[model samples]
Target: MILERQNFMNINQISAELEKEFTNKSIEQEDIEKLQALARLYQLYQAGANEIGTKLENLDAEFQVNYDHNPIHHMEERMKSVQSLLNKLVKKGYALSVENVRAHIFDIAGIRVVTNYIDDVYLIEKMLLNQSDVTLMQRKDYIAQPKTSGYRSLHIVVSVPVFQSTGSKPVNVEIQIRTVGMDMWASLEHKLRYKTDIEAELVDHYGADLHDYATELSGIEIKMQALYQKLNQYKN
Candidate 1:
């Protein structure tokens, strides 16, 4: 699949729009649940920024996540330096027009889970599926059967607990599990889509090389991370 760049503005711009829209809106019929969901989304963004930022606070001043690119601006390049979970209450109705709400949410909410190996991706997928508070709505294993365009990742829909005053209620969440290699390719692809729309470069010269490197490195990563697993077992 081609990288798609929507009319996605930065967080600051989105916030300004929201402030303006809500400021003069005393008569708009809005549901409380939808508003609460939007609030939760903003809160999650803050939490993610905090968690990743603090963990890498002491990193080298010159160190960057992407190849020759600034990590702070493009946050996801830091090899799992980013972990995001978005919550939104999509406006739903019992009709075809509203049915697209669910589709659109998946279009943007889930993050690309970049791991080092195929096993890592499977482990994460299984771990979340086993969660008592999470319900698996669906799963599409693309790693096993990669796309015609050479994309490798797993897409899953899971519902998580959202504890309301009454009790804990299940809320659906979108999860896309991949590898660092996948993220690199996806990142470049997204950039190209922005530059040329669909008619972007048919094959990324630099991206193909990066993909090969990631595939080889992933093997080493699996071995190294597995050693840690063995250590934990031995310690136990």
Candidate 2:
């Protein structure tokens, strides 16, 4: 316990020094308090992501036991780093304060749910949204209307209350639901567009090819969905 307390004190000292450096001013009690609060807020966001992940896992388990089918193939959850959050706030012309971050940023925590079939995406979405605690703040149906770059997914921003020592605080989390095919194309497309250094004309050529590939993937996903429905028609 003594060692732990020493470590904690050292961490606090480091945090205060870092804050002072960033602000270019002497650290005061009020600033220390604000920094602690900001740290708690990030912890809350990570807890929110974990809460959503648990909900998705539970739903998948329920489907498997009750319906003999599992909709969710896999899930990925992430929390935005402090640097990333600050960068985004600056890019969006928002003030660099905890208050502005809470008010403006809704995607500090994110989850991506990948399903086997396209319809499974909607099924999981409906089930999740039906929960009372999950409040839908925004919905963007890119699957129905694909992006110009051929990215397709159902994006939803939701607020879920996370219980804390003080009280229950509502936290925002962004959810993306898509089929395996869509996820595959999106992953590769992102790499090609962002990681490569092809010339302008070649980039255009690759872009067209990627668009065509996305279309083909969509068609394949639809067919796979139909096949799944036919196979499980009598099971459920």
Point to the candidate with the largest TM-score.
Answer: 2
Relative to the true structure, candidate 2 has a C-alpha RMSD (angstroms) of: 6.1
Q: Score residue 32 of candidate 2 by CA lDDT.
A: 79
Q: What is the alpha-carbon lDDT of model 1 when measured against the actual structure?
A: 0.47
lDDT tens per residue, model 2, 1-236: 00000112233543554375468677778877777777767777877887888888889999989888889988888766566777888899986668998999989888888898888889988999899999999999999999998899999999999998989999999999998888988888888878888887887888899999999989988887788778877663
Per residue, candidate 1 scores C-alpha lDDT tens digits across 127-167 of 55664655777788877776644556788866555544566
TM per candidate: 0.50, 0.87
- Candidate 2 residue spans exceeding 4 A from truth: 1-32, 234-236
Worst 10 residues of 2 by lDDT: 1-10
TM-score, cand. 2: 0.87
> Which candidate should be chosen as best, given lDDT against the real structure?
2
